[model samples]
Target: MRVLAIIVLALIGSAGAEAREAQEGRADLKHEILKRLHDPNAARRRDALLMLGTFTDVPLSPILHSATDDPDPGVRAAAIMALGHASHASNAQELIPTLLRALKDSHPLVRRAAAGVLGRVRDPRAVRALQEAARDRDAAVRAAAVEALGEQGDQAALTTLLERLRDKDPFVRRQAARAIGRLRAPTALAALLERLVREEDVDVKRAIAWALGEIGNPHAAETLRTLSRSTDPYLSATAREALKRLISDATARSRRR
Candidate 1:
């Protein structure tokens, strides 16, 4: 019994010592990153922000928060991305204000990054800002904002996403279709079907088909069946898959009744 107790004590001591060493190592890394963030070179500061972003286990929000104001737009964008990486559900809401401000940054790249991160944060408070960003002049920013609003899953942003389905940019339209699918709102069915009929972009058509499948509306079954006969193998396959989902969902609903 005495020997067993001594062995247990030794193990506990070893574990405690290892934990302390890891904590010290993390502290050292944090100090080095902080020092580099202040470097005169913008690239160096951006690099530090990138590195800090990967330190998800560390509570470095203060440093990342300040970096968002860096003079270099690239650095500011990187800081916003880093903040997204470091944030989790518990602390995400705390940073929504900072992200909202970045969403309005004069630099398109910075605004794009902010919109993308706001999606990761998934705060309802950002839904309105993201909806506004969906109208950004830059196509890339608009695409990012549309994607973010989809991530928000708020029904309030549904109208904006539906409007983006007709955006001049095919990429934004594709993203809008996918976002509508993510929402899985039956109300979006008619819009998705309408766009699918008029969409010349094969990629956008495929996204619309996928959205129809995700919504699993029986009304879409006839369209999906006709689409399944299309010459484009990819589109036909997507439509066939959507039909399967509609059938499966119908079965589920019947069983529930």
Candidate 2:
């Protein structure tokens, strides 16, 4: 009994010492990464900012806040995603204001990056900001916002998503259509069905078809059946596949009932 007690105490001491060593190593690595933040080259600074995200759930804290306004748009954008890596709740909260501010950044790249980070953070509070960003003058930024709103999957964003369906940019419209599906917005069924007929962009059409399948309203079945016979092989195949998926989901639901 005495020998067993000594062995257990030694193992515990060794584990504690190893944990301390790991903590010190992590601190040293962070110090090195911080030094690179001031690198003469913007690309180097951006790379350093991204490297900070791999710090194994360590909060970048004060440094991350300042980097949000870095002169290089790329660095600022990297800061956006790095903020998502913050493991501490308080540190992550610091990003909320910065993310909102970045949505209005002069550079479209910064705005788009902020939108994506907001989604990755998965904060419901960002839904309103994402909705406004969806109307950004830059189509890519608008698309990013739509994608972010989709990640949120909030029904409140359905209106903004519905409006974006008519955005002048085909990419924005396609993303909005896809976001609607992610939100499972039932009100969008009519719009998607209407767009399927007049939408000239094959990519946007495909997105709408997919959204219809995801929504899976009985009314959409006729459209899917008709499209199943389309001369466009991809569209026909997608429609046929969507029908099967919807039918399967409906069957599963009915059985559960």
Candidate 3:
């Protein structure tokens, strides 16, 4: 009991120290942000906006809104990202409509940044808009939209993700595979297996392998074992690791039953 009490006391002290450090860190960051915000240089202000996109960020209303129209493309992109982070941080559902509108921003970078924020929101309001943005002309924007759809945790995204697996851009296909894993639906496993066989990109194959591990279905064990023997060292190593994970997970489940 003394040892347990000592451990508890240590944890309490550690937590208190962490809290104090966080408070101090936020104060320092805010001061720097303010200094940069008031600077005559647009680059400095952009730097401020970038910091404001972080976890300790406080939304500088109307300012952040106006920053979205800054003359510099980089500043505008950073501002859009900051707004989304701020909205998610503050639970400002009112910001949803603004973020959704940003998905159509003239700049694909702005649209990409906005898609990221909406994904964090995970609000149903952003789902349809994200789906449309998934078809954006820019591959990066499409990848971003697919990523957001995955984070939203909506079952409706399952069909969208399935279709995106065949996207011309390999990045989008990988993101789709990762999202399908996030859904954890058994039905997605077969599609993943089919894609895994035809997928030539090592990165996409790795993503699929990790997704299969996330699904934790023993049915993938045989396929994983075959991939584990492939000539590609990275792919073979990852597949072997995933195979072990599947077997251990299956064993745990069976024991519980």
Candidate 4:
């Protein structure tokens, strides 16, 4: 009897309408974006957020805040991006902090998405949060944070950026080294030089060589000279070019002094 009941249940579930409704509802979803902004159903709320971000009809900041704290992480991630996608310059001040909070979400995707949105914010207040997120467990989030720090372009971030140069993930290290290059801080010369000597990752070595040239300090000249002798042709060529620029820049600075 039990075997017969199980067979009957399997046949009933095989009928297609329920499966079709779920798939079709997701595909044909065109709910009134604003009316469903605070809908009780999780699916409706998520759909509303997607619409609010993709469409320009909604300018709902209150709905954005509620979504930011939604029990569903996917909903919260969408809400964070929606704030930036819909907001103009006037609302950047309010949106930056919320975006920073999203970086600390338990969900890796949320943190990664928040990191990307924060980079576009251009708010100085976001620098500290971006720096902290450079240590995020997710490589994508760490890379995004490094890129965001570059967007800030503040010399104050130099120390934090130097620390990331040693990140276990070569991608994160490369991104950090690239951001350091964008800063053009002379103080970064020592760190960049050390990384050039110690870093085994070829891409990271190349980025360090570029950052040394960008920093343009005479202190980096000898490091560049040493790297120019490397067996790796690419590193040798980059080092030669960087040495020329650093020497030229140092000569120019000495003339001015």
Give all TM-scores, in the order shown: 0.88, 0.85, 0.81, 0.69
Error of 4 at 117 (Å): 2.3
Error (Å) of candidate 2 at residue 88 is 6.5
Q: Which has the higher TM-score value, candidate number 1 or candidate number 2?
A: 1
Model 3 backbone overlap count:
0
Give the per-residue lDDT digits (tens) of candidate 2, residues 138-160: 99999999999998888999999
Tens digit per residue, CA lDDT, model 3, 1-257? 99999999999999999999999988987878867766778788888888776744454667788788777767777888777666645466767877877788888888998888888875678888888888899999999999999898899888889999989999999999888888877789999999988889988998888788788899998888888898989888888888888889999999999
Error of 1 at 163 (Å): 1.0
Question: Quick one: best lDDT, which candidate?
Answer: 1
Query: What overall lDDT goes with each candidate model?
Result: 0.92, 0.86, 0.84, 0.82
Q: How far is candidate 4 from the true structure (C-alpha RMSD, Å)?
A: 13.5
Candidates by lDDT, descending order: 1, 2, 3, 4
lDDT of 1 by residue, 20-111 (tens): 99999998998899799999999999999999888866668988999888999999999999998888889899989999999889999999
Give the range of the ten consecutive residues with the poorest summed lDDT in model 4. Answer: 26-35
Error of 1 at 90 (Å): 3.7
Q: Which residue pairs of candidate 4 clash?
A: none
Clashes of 1: 0
Q: Which stretches of model 1 miss by more than 4 angstroms?
A: 1-20, 56-59, 122-124
Which of candidates 1 and 3 reaches a greater lDDT?
Answer: 1
List, residue by residue over 1-257, the lDDT tens digit for candidate 4: 99999998988787666888876675455356666766788777777887777655445688787789999887888888787787877777888768877888999878987887787777667888888898888888898889878778888778888999989899988989889989998777777777766888988898888888888878788878888998989989998998898888889988999
